[model samples]
Every structure is written in structure tokens, then in C-alpha cells.
Target chain A: MLKIENLQARIEEKEILRGINLDIKPGEVHAIMGPNGSGKSTLASVLAGREDYEVTGGSVDFLGKDLLELSPEDRAKEGLFLAFQYPVEIPGVSTTNFMKTALNEKRKYHGLDPLDAAQFLKLMKEKMKLVQIDQALLSRSLNEGFSGGEKKRNEIFQMAMLEPKLAILDETDSGLDIDALRIVANGVNQLRSKDNSFLVVTHYQRLLEYIVPDYVHVLYKGRIVKSGTKDLALELEERGYDFIKEEVDQAIA
Target chain B: MDVKSNLKTAYSQQEGNSTHLASFQTENWKTFSGMGIPALKHEEWKYIPVKNIFKDEMNIAIESSNLEDTIIKKSILPGTEEANTIVFFNGRFQADHSIIHEKDALVVKSLETAAGDEDALFVEEHLGHSQAYHPDGVNALNGAFASGGAFIKLKKGKSLLQPLIIYHFSDSSNGFRFSQPRILASIEANAQITIVETYINIGGGESFTNEVIEICTGRDSITRYIKLQNEGKHSNHTGTTHVRQLERSNTHAVTITLDGAIVRNNLNMVMEDEHAESHMYGLYLLNGNTIADNHTIVDNRMPHCESNELYKGIMDDQSTGVFNGKIFVRKDSQKTNAYQSNKNILIGDQASANTKPQLEIFADDVKCSHGCTIGKLDEDALFYLRARGISEKNAKALLLQAFASDILGQIEHEAIKNYIEQLISERLSFQA
Candidate 1:
């Protein structure tokens, strides 16, 4: 479903992602665990085609298409979603309107007929029930005065609406409580299918306990150093990322 | 007599001398020519440079014999079938074209005819007060050239079923023109009315509009005024609206400045009686090299009065925006609440905004606050929309529309609000 070859990216003159190479197939869920400055979010931003990040020497292929060559809108139309760590607070755009425009734009890109107002509202109601987001909240401006957990849940709600092929959860679980975490995880698990995949980028293993990734990878200094089963997340949580840094130093030496 | 003399020559060479200045008109002209167009050095006109727009000569259109019929039709409102409309061509009233039925609650006629009648006491009293409140030279110039002023008076305890639309059409095909149309409006107690005023350029050269409108709101009256300015690129406009709340009244006004080469609007509201309420909202979306400035002053002289103001600007290309809002609470004006906010979005690096919202409170028991924000479009919001498969252009338009909705929602007239919404959409879609 996704392939990254020597993904070297930078912001300004400072190199954030040195050389990242990752490969994941359909129906696979990958959890990338890293320290604070370990390029975890950088990888997500590069994959999502953020304009601020410059890919110095790398190539990203999503479903065998040149991802780096596409614009951000094209990247989104190609079924690539990035749930921002801190979702933006848009004051005037209502959540329902924003979501409807997004969904219809993506649908139009896929050559599908746009949903009418009644059908769109019906689908929104169903998705809202799945994520437990209230109807009144969707009527207000998107994240205008939302709480931390509400914003995170709203991101998940948007995910449920768009239903992207490759979902990149970038620190979405950081500000959520236990209840919201379970709800968000439940929504993601419900949307999971054999034809889709997820790249969960988080700093803690707490989110992994809920989402339960198929493979856990320790990323240090932009590169994924090790890959293992879910147990690796529990081990890393217990020992912390210092253990990974020591192992990396010893390996280099 | 340095720069002022040169300006006098410029004004005389363009507009020529008025032959009707035999009575009080000549006195007004002497008072006007004595003080040329106020420079940036003046206190009231400090933030605005008025000399640039009027540096050259501008002739008032003289040939009223040949007027374009299509220009008059195009200037009317979209769905104004029963409107009491007044058409002003080159700052002179076109009596043959204006239609004001006797049965309507509104009395629309020329200020010249209404001035000598005993029924026009309101017009006689309130005509020159705006200039008195703001004694700048440009205000005097408008008073001096007040050729064909429009008078609208709503009778006591009456509500107009239809709107009163005033169109100021500028035809400067011969040469540069200077047009001034004074407006006198008096809303009686408990009366409700909506007044829509706009400017139109029929044959464009260089046209300058120096207009003043005086409004007197009676006790418990409701008044709404909408000013829409989309003049030609060579047009320059300087408008002043001095509204007075004679008693406990409510006034809601929205000023939309969409496209203009040089536009300056001065709005002043004086709360004379207790329990008066005023709400002022403005939206200025300027593109190209256009410049728009809005300067407002709300004076709370009585007790328990409230006033709230919000002005937003979306500037692109090399356009510039300026907002200066001042709220003054007098010492005796206790229990007064005044709030003012100004926000501007600069789309390009070259686009700029100068916003200053000031509050001078002398009353200790009053609540007054003012704030201004000048920023670019939110990048995070832009990404959030674009990441949802929305095109970048549409995303920007959505964000801008949302930013403008706060002010647009204040339009009390549904048709006017819809008209503005469509205008904003068209403006956003036309990408230069």
C-alpha cells in the first residue's frame, strides 16, 4: 500500500528526516514509536505532502503512484489522510460543511457521483454515531472553541467521513482521555478492512494498547532501527527510548 | 498658501464656479475655499491622505440634457420593484427619472425644494450638522457643492413597506468630475426603515465623490443603512455619515466596500439620550492597488447607552486597508458598554493593514474595550481544508467567506445580505 525509499526531508536548512525507508502492505497497521525529536511527525508530514517540508533526496510511492509529485490536494484525493496532532481551529467553517465539502471533493476525484444534501446528512448521522460526536457540535465552526478531547475526536470523525486508503494518525491520541481513546480506536477498528492500511505515529505506547498495531517499529534519528511484534511497544514503554539510543550507539560503534 | 493654494487652483479649474452661490451658497463656498482639502497634517484626516485623490482637477458633470437611460436602470437594486428610488446624475437630481408615490410612507424629494417649506424642519436642522461635527475642509466642500441633495423623511410612527434606494451615478466622460450629494434622513419615533445607498460610474474618467449623510433617529426608532461602494478604478470617494440618537433609539448599519481605487468612510454616532443602542459592522474586501480606510467615532454622552462595532478587511495583491475606531464615554455616561474589534487578513506579502481601535473612557462605571488584529490567512486551516481533497483556491475562498460571515450576518435585510454574499462569491472566484 505504501513505500518510502531513502526519504530525506528538511525544514529550512535543518535536516529532520535523514534517510527513511519503509514498506507496508494492505491490511497492515504499523506503529512508529520514537522519542520527541526522532522525526516521527516529520515522516507523517512528508508523506502527507506538507509544503513546508523539502524532500532533499527521497521518493514516496502510495499504491504504486508517485506520491511526491502530487500536490497536497492530489495527495488527499489519492486517499492519503493525516490526522494532525493539533487539529486547526477554523472559526467560520462549520464541521458539517467542511466535512461535506471534503467528502464530495474526494468523491469527485474518484469519479463518483456527489452525495445530495439528504444522503450526505444521513451518512453524517451514521458516522457521528460511530464516533460518538454530537450533532450540535458538528453544526458549530470547526474546532472554534472545542476542548482537547473534542478536537481529537473530531479528527477521528473526519477520518470516518473521508475513509482514506492510507490513514496516517500523527499523534492523534496525545490529548485524548481514556474514554475518547477507546472511542477513537473503536472507530478506526470499525473502518479497518483488507484493502486499507494505517500508519500510526505516536510517542507513547498507551495509544498502541488501544489501536493494537500489527507491527511496532522503533524510529531513531529519522530511520526505523528495529521492527517487531506488539510486545516491542510494551518493552519500549517500560525501558524508554534511551534504551534504543544506547542500542543504536553500540551498533554504530 | 503653499500646497493649499495649488489645491484651490486644482479645484476651481475642474469643477468651475457655481452660479447659484448668491445666497448662503456663496458663504459656504468662501468657507470651503478658505480651507482647502485637509492634508494628512490635520487631526481628523491624519491617517488618510485626501490630497492624492483630489490632486488633479475634477469637473462636476454639467450636461444634464443628455443622460444615459441604461445607467439609471443598471444602478437600481436587484429586486426593487416597489422601491421609492431617487436617481442623482452627476450630483444633480434627475427629477424626471425619480419616482416617489404619494401613498408611500417615505417622502423623497430634492433638498432645494424641501429647504424653503415649513414641512422640512428636520432637513433644515440636520443638513449641516454633519459638517459641524466634523469641520474638515472636504466636508465643507461637499456642503458648498451640495447641488441636488436627497431628503428622506419617514412620518411619525410609520414603517416603510419597501426600501428607499439612492443611486449616485457619475458620468465623467467629458472630463474629471467632482460630485457631492447631501442626504438628510429623519426616522420618526417607532418607525422602521431600510436605506440602501451606492455609487455608479456611467462614463468613467476620473470621478471624485465627497458625500455627507445626516441621520436623526427618534425615540425607540429602528434605522438601518447600508452603503455599498463598487465604483470604477479611477473613482475616488470620501463619505461621512453623522448619525444622532435623539432619544432612546436603535441603529444598525453595515458598510460594504468591495472594490474602489481610493475610498474613505467616516462614520460618527452621538448617543444623546439614555438607553440608545448602536451596532456598526463593516466589511472591506480590497484587491489590486485599491486603498480603503474606515474611521469611526462613537460618543456615549448619556447613561446606560451601548455600542458595539466590528470591521473586517480581506486585502490581496498590493491593496492596503486602514481601520481607526474610537469610542468615547463621557464622565456622566455611567453604565455604558462599548466594544470595538477590527480584524484584517493580508493575502499577499505586499498587502498591508493599519488598524487602530482606541477607547477613551472618562466614566469610571463604564465598560469599554477595543482591539485590533492584522494577520495573514491561517496556514494550518488552509492545510486542513486542502488535506480534505478541496482545491487550494476553494479552500482559501471558504476560509475568507467564513472570516467575513461574522460581519455579513449583521445585515438585517435578507435580500441585501444575499446580494452581498453573491458579490463576495464572485469577487473570490475572479482570481487575478
Candidate 2:
């Protein structure tokens, strides 16, 4: 579903993602694990088209279209979703209103008629049950004073609402407690289908325990140095990223 | 054609035999002459320049109180069909255009008649209570020419089924127009009511409106007041909504200033008895060269009283917004709780906001807090919305509306609230 070849990027004077190459097919969930400052989050941001980063080199293609040419909103309209590391707290806008706007806009891009009030609410209820989100929480402001778990579950709820072709989870497990992690992972697992894919970016392999990625790639110093199966995640969790760094340094030497 | 002499000419034209009201008007005229119009050097009117707004050739209407029915019909708010519609043409109460839904529940009369009616003593005692809080010319200036104002009285223990909509219409087609509208509302004991005041400028020329509304709530009474100002750039306004809460009474006031050339509002909440509660809220969303100045005062005179105030504004283009909120707890008012907050957002390079929240607590045992903030839109929040398939313009508009929702929530009337929301959405559509 997504192809990234030598995806080099930087912010200001600091180089973050350097020569990253990754490809994910339909129905696949790929996990990228790295130490802090290893460009894991930067890769997710670059894919989602955050304007602050300079694309120095390389291109990202999603569904045979040049993803770099689209605006952030247009990218979403084209079925690209990025679950932010820290969901913004927008007071006064209910989660219901937010999702309605996003869903309607995405539907418009597909040349579909906008959903009426009853239709939107019904769809929201179905997705809400799948994500295990309380009905009262959806009536309040968007992520305003939401718990760490509620924020992640809301992201999954939005994913269900949009049914995107590609969803990038950036540090979705950063602040989650054990229970919250389980709920969030269950939500993602329920939404997994044959046509959609996910790029799970995390520093700890603990998140991989629940989602169980198909491909485990170790990122170091802005490059993907190693790739293997699910057992590689347990191996990295056992030995940490230091062993991967040493392996990359020896390969360069 | 000086402003003071023009005011004198208007004051001397009243043929009424109400000696007490005449004497009160004379004193205020003296005060207006002594204080003149505040200049840049004055502290209260520092940001508001009153000198440029007063033209020597402006005509103050006295006989054109007959407002057209069609015009009055167009000026009514959305859900006000069942309301007691009170129309004021050029600051004079037009009985023909006004409606009294329930004569037993409410009594609407002119200030001239109120002075000679059964409520004469109550009117005389509380006529100029707002002037006591200000020694400046602005409050007193409106008092100097308090001609043809409305007097609204709620019968004791009787609640009205519909709200009261007061429309202040200024027809400046003849030339420049000046209006001084005065309102006195007495909500008797155990009575409850809502009063919504809106402005209308029907002409193309310059208009200056100086209005003062004083309300008194008796024991166990509840009053909700909403003031909406959406006049054109040719109109300059200085208005005040002064509310006094008696023993065990409650009052809530919301001031919304959308657009005008120069607009200044003074909202005063005076708590006179124990266990009294009051609330004051204001939202000023402006663009162009519009200037909105909101000054609020919550005076806690008795013990065990509480007052809460919140005012938010969004300024764009070259527009400027100013907020000055003050809470005063007297020495005898122990255990008083007063809180005030003012926040603003500047959406343009030339847009500006100045906020000052002050608390004056003479009692050592009281609790009072005041705060103010001025900033631009949050970039992170903007990005969050855009990443969800929303345009940058729509994102900012949504976030701003969200920021304004808490203030909008205070409007008890759904039609008026939705109408204001619609106006704000249109105003914010062009903003990024």
C-alpha cells in the first residue's frame, strides 16, 4: 500500500530521517522500533506530510500516487491517516462534530453524498462500540482532559470511522497504561482487514506484543538496518537497540 | 453646536412637571459640563478616543418616535415572535411599535410616565446608580440627556412566559444621529425574566449612541440580560448595562460586540445584600478597524456574596479589542468570593488586544482572583485539525469557535445563541 525509497528528511539544521527505504503490501502491519532520536517519529511525520520538515531527498508513493505532492488534508482525503503522538485538545468541539466533519470531507472526495444527522450518529454508534468508547466521552470536547487510553482509543475510533487505506500510528503507545494498551490494541486488531495497512512506530517492543506486526525492522541513526519476523521483536526486546547499533557500525566499517 | 450645549438644549425641551427627575437631569448635565468628554490623558477612556466621535452638526431626534411597522418587524430577533417586543426609535419608546404580551405579568411604560406612576419612588431612588460607580463623563453624559427611555416592571412573584426583546433603532438618513437610550427594569421578588437588547442602524450616515440600562432585582428574583451590538462602521457606541442585586437575588449579563467603528461597553454588577450571586460574560469578535472596549465591575457590598466574570475576544485585521474588569469587595463584605478572567486572540498582524483584570479587596477574609491573556491561534491545534482532512482556514475557524463555545454556552435563548454563532461563523470564514 505504501512505498518509501531513500526517504531523507530533516528539521532546521538537524538531519532526522536519512535514506529510509520501506515497503508494505496490503493487509500488512509493519513495525519500526528504534532508540530515541533515531528518526522513528520523523518517518511517520514525513509520511503524513508535516510541513515543518524539509524533504531533502526521496519520495513516498501510496496506492501508485505521489504522496509528497498532496496537502495534509488531501492526503487524508486520499485515505492516509496519521494518529498523532499527542492528540490536540480542542475545547468546545465535540468528538462527534470533529469526526462528522472529517468523515463528510473524506466522503465528498470520493464523490459520495454527505451523511445526514441520523446516518452520522448511527455510524458513530457502531464504530464507537467497536472501539469500546463511552457514549458520553464522544459528546465532550475533542480529547480535552481525556485519559491516555481514551486518546488512543479515540484515534482507533477515528480510523474505524474513516476506514482509511493506510493508517500510521506514531508513538501510540507512549503514555498508555497496561489496560489502555490492551484496549487500543484490541481496537486496531478489530479494524484490520485485507485492503488496509498500518505502520506502527514505537521505541518499545511492548506494543508489538498486542498488534503482532508482520515485519519487525530495527531503525538506527535514521536508516532501517535490519528486518525480520515477529521473533525479531522479542529478540530486540531481550538485547535492546545497542546490539543493532553495533551491528550497523560494524557493517559500515 | 457644542456637545454640552446640545445636551442642554435637549434637556431644557422636556415639558414634564417631574421636579425630582428634572433636578436629577440638571445635576448630571452639570457633571457632564465639568468633566466634558474624556481625552487620551484620562485613565478610564485611555484606549477610547471620544473626541473624534462627536460631530457638531449631528441631529438629536426628539419628535421622530413613530417607527415603521415593516422596519420594526424586520428588526425582531428569530425566536422573538412570542416575546414582548419593545421598540425604541431614536432613543424614544414607541408605544405603537411595541408589544405587551401579558399586561398582568409585565408593565411597560415611558420614563416620563414611570416618574409619575406608582413606581415613581423606586425609579427615583435607582435612576442614576450607575453614575455613582463612575465620576467620568461617559456614564453621566448619558444621564444628562435621558429623554424618552423605557421603564419595564415585573409584577411581584409573577414570571413571564416569553422574554423581552428591546430593539434600539437609529435612523440616521436625515444626517448624523445621536441617541441616548435609558432603560430601568425592576424584577420584583420571586420573579424571573430575560431581557435581550439588540442594536439597529438603518441609515448610511454617521451615528453615535450613548445608552445606559439600570436593572434592580428584588429578593429571590432572577434576571438574565443579553446585549448584542452588530452596528455598522459608521456607528460609534458607548453603552452600559448596570445591574443591582438585592437580598438573595441573582443576575447574569452577557455582552456581545460583533462590529462597529468604535464600541465601548461598561457592565457593572452591584451585589447589595448577603448571599447574592452575579455573573458577567462578554464576547467581542471584531474585524476591520473596529474597536471594542469592555469594562466590567463587580461590586460586592455585603458579606457572603459571590461573583464570577469571564470575557473573551477575537480580533482580526486592524481591529483592536480592550478589556478592563474590576472586582471590589468592601471591608464589611467578609467571606466574599469573586473571580474574573479575560482572554483574547489576535488573528492578524495589525490586530491587537489590551486586557487588565483587577481586584480590589478591602476585606482581609475574602477571596478574589483576576487574570488576563492575549495570544494567537495555537499552531499545534491547527495542524491537528488539518491532518484530519480539514483545510487550514476551516481548522482555524473550528478551533476558534471551540474556544468561543464556553462563552456562547451562557446564552439561555437558543435562537439568539444560534444567530450569534451564525454571525461568528461568517465573520471567521474569511480568516485563516
Top DockQ hit: 2
**Candidate 2 off by > 4 Å:** A177-179, B1-11, B16-18, B430-432
Per-residue alpha-carbon lDDT of candidate 2 for residues A82-138, written as tens digits (9 for 90 to 100):
998889888888999888888887788789999999999999999998878999999
Chain B TM-score for the candidates in order: 0.92, 0.97
Q: How does candidate 2 fare on TM-score?
A: 0.96
Quality of candidate 2's docking, in CAPRI categories?
A: medium
lDDT (tens digit, per residue) of candidate 1 on A30-105: 9999999999998998888889999999888898899999988899899999998988999988999888888888
In model 1, state the lDDT of residue B92: 70
